[model samples]
Target: MEKERRWTEKYRHLLQAFYFAFTNGYARGYTNGMIFTGKSKYLCVPGLNCYSCPGAIGACPIGSLQAILGSNTYRISLYVSGMLALFGVFFGRLVCGFLCPFGLVQDLLYKIPFPIKKKNLPAHNQLKYLRYVILAVFVILLTSLIHDVTGTGIPWFCEWICPSGTLLAGVPLMILNPEFREAIGFQFFWKMGILLVIMLGSVAYYRPFCKYLCPLGAIYGVFNPVSTYRLVIDKEKCVNCGSCQKACLMDIRTNQTPNSPDCIRCLKCVSACPTGAIDSSWNIARSKFESRLLSEEENSPNPEVTKTTLLAILTIIAGLATMVSTFKYNLDGVLVYHFSGLTSGRGVLAYMLVTLFKGIVSFFMIITGYKLFINRNDENAVHRFREQTRMILKFVIIIVIAGIASLFADLSLLSVMFNAILICPFPIIGLPLLASAASSTDKLVQGKGSAVLWWIVFVLLAVVTSYIAYISTVIILAG
Candidate 1:
């Protein structure tokens, strides 16, 4: 019996590790410019896998939840909600124990060879409720509420808080994309700080994020009592031993409540049960019977909706201000033009960096303006026009800055690289934005020749830019 229990524990760990590897097998550590953009990305995985990971083939449920909520549509995505509900109802927190990449990370972190001591600190139990608070405020309320006021919603939790995302996706992307590294600001540092704290906490506590701050975990946990898959306690076979509770990483009092909300369905309790009193099952009737035997309600504090509203409003204002400042700074100062005699190697590198920066900035600006235009109601047409004008002014300022910098140095290589990067991404990103903007303008103001004229001018500019880039590249290479 002891040997069988040991094997069960070992096999569970191996199974979890297998699932982690299987889910992230696309790039498989070959972090070049490789990302799986296949059809599988539309599907949400049952675990917290970062979509930005080079190897990830599926979207993260929490990230998707936040994104749909924060969309301008302001409608709940039945597809995403249905997926989450299905996963929760069927498997409960088994997803956390046997699937989540971050859950596996925490488990491995806890196993490091150190004098690891588990302490039941004061307020530890209360901390378990924090994930629910995060779910309510960041994942659901903030995303749905912010779009009404800002014309654009922020994925507040994913953008500002997800440590798993920072570690799994942000770090790898920054390492791979030099342009993303160059664009890093205070937010990157803030996220790294959060990731660091979580890492350190994971070393000491078992599944700290799952226990205290995973919104997905909180979501799955709600179905613990009635989920089709469940952990059951056989009172007839029980010896009043506390071994199962001791084995539980989630700090679940399994002897008293087998299907506790905090349980990860890890089966550690099942393995540790001395008299084989604990078992797992897939019967709805059994789950219902077990739930009746042990009934406990988890009490969580209600979120302050008023405070959340005020914070969301302030965040949008602050974000817009920051965006303007960052855009101006990137355009004016990100590229440094050397007046010294440039070597071929140095010139090429410098040209590439500047071009990359310009491409990224242009893509963002066009997308932002496009979203504002399309999402604006008739009453907000003037506001959208003003915003678009400001963006255009910013673009003009960037062009002027580049022109001034060109005068100080040999711009042959720089101009070629800049135009190449600009023209390539502009069509990919700008075409959609332009089409959307034109469509929106036509609907709002009929007989608007201004939109048509602007479209013609943009086409002309693109053609001219592409021609210049092609000619310059040919000339430089030939020389």
Candidate 2:
């Protein structure tokens, strides 16, 4: 029995290693620090393996899902979604236990000698719900709802959250690609902070991410109750000993619930059952007596943070992106690259504000271009192109009108409402002026003190820039 346990453990690890190697088999790409943009890239791997990983031959399902959700067309990733549903219906968290490379990483991390290991985290039950929140917010809501100028949503999970990509894909690419390394900034460090916390947490707690923060795991776990393969307990042979619970690393009370959603099908509970009551099964034909013995009441399970922290983190990320845009825009240089600082003291403060707004636009443009490019051949590229074109036209019309008005003011409109003052404040001032014109009050803008303050500042700066331009033009004419 002990040998069986050992052999099973070894087999799971071996399978994990082989699967990881197979998913990331383009060793030469790793050597050259390149991504494999081959036919196999169309396939989605059933793990959290990164598509951007140098050696990865297949795409990560979650990333693929995000790309589709965040695209201009906002189409569902049928391929990725189908793959996930298929995997979930069949395997559930078995992938977490035996297939996910990140899962294996956490398993290996736990094996390293540690002074004090915890059986369960504090508030483990409630905390487990966090993965669901992440799935809903980062993976779905942010990716689908919040869009940029290009009508492309950002993959908020990959951009600001995923530690797996940071550790597995980001680090290796950073080591290989000079340009990628150069682009690394606060975003990279923010990801590293998340990664460090997961690594340290895993050392003390088993599979902390799989238990709590993994959006993929949360998705798979939902199918566990209905999955084709499942863990079973024979009630006739069962003596209600706590041995199974003792051996189960997931803190699952298997005696009451043999097929708990959290169960990774590690088989520890099966191996530890003194009466040999626990077993893995596919609901094959069995005698009525045996079926009754396996059956128990279905009633079971357990269930159930930082709004300010999230706000601060998001603000920091936004500020960093804005900062990067103001001076040297690395985002495909939609326009001028270098510029004076926000406090350059030339009454050109609107330029700073414009750059901030530009950065915001550039983020969407950059992400949209990336998503469209990456998933172009992978999907209906034609639909995406059309969607983007329509969105661009709608925005361009506004910018054109703003441009004409700004030309009169000798101002560079960057704000959207400029769809008044002009090239620079076109979008920012767009809604307010339009709304004010219609209703005599921009309720949304007027309701917020901060919004009102920023609007005042923008107008004052624009007037100053117009005066500067007029003076310069007059001097040039006189000369």
Q: Find the candidate with the highest TM-score and give its number.
A: 2
Q: Residue 282 CA error for candidate 1 (Å)?
A: 3.7
Per-residue lDDT, model 1, residue 368, is 50
TM-score of each candidate structure, all chains considered together: 0.57, 0.58
lDDT of 1 by residue, 241-349 (tens): 8898788877777979888888887788888888888777754476577566345212213222222222223223322332433344333333433334344545544
lDDT per residue as tens, model 2, 1-479: 45665577668888898999988899887787788899998888888998999889988989999999989874677877889999999998888888898998998899889998986789998998999999999999989998989899899999998888988899998998898888989999999999999999899999898888899998998888888877777889889989999998899989888767788877778778888777666533344455553452122121001211222222233323333433343222323322433222322333334444455543543444444445534334324533543453355454454445444554333332242223333223332332232232223223475456446544644543564465457547857
RMSD after CA superposition, every candidate: 22.8, 24.2
* Model 1: residues with Cα > 4 Å off, grouped in runs: 1-6, 119-121, 148-150, 283-479
Q: Which residue pairs overlap in candidate 1's backbone?
A: none
RMSD of 2: 24.2
What total of clashing residue pairs does each candidate reach? 0, 24
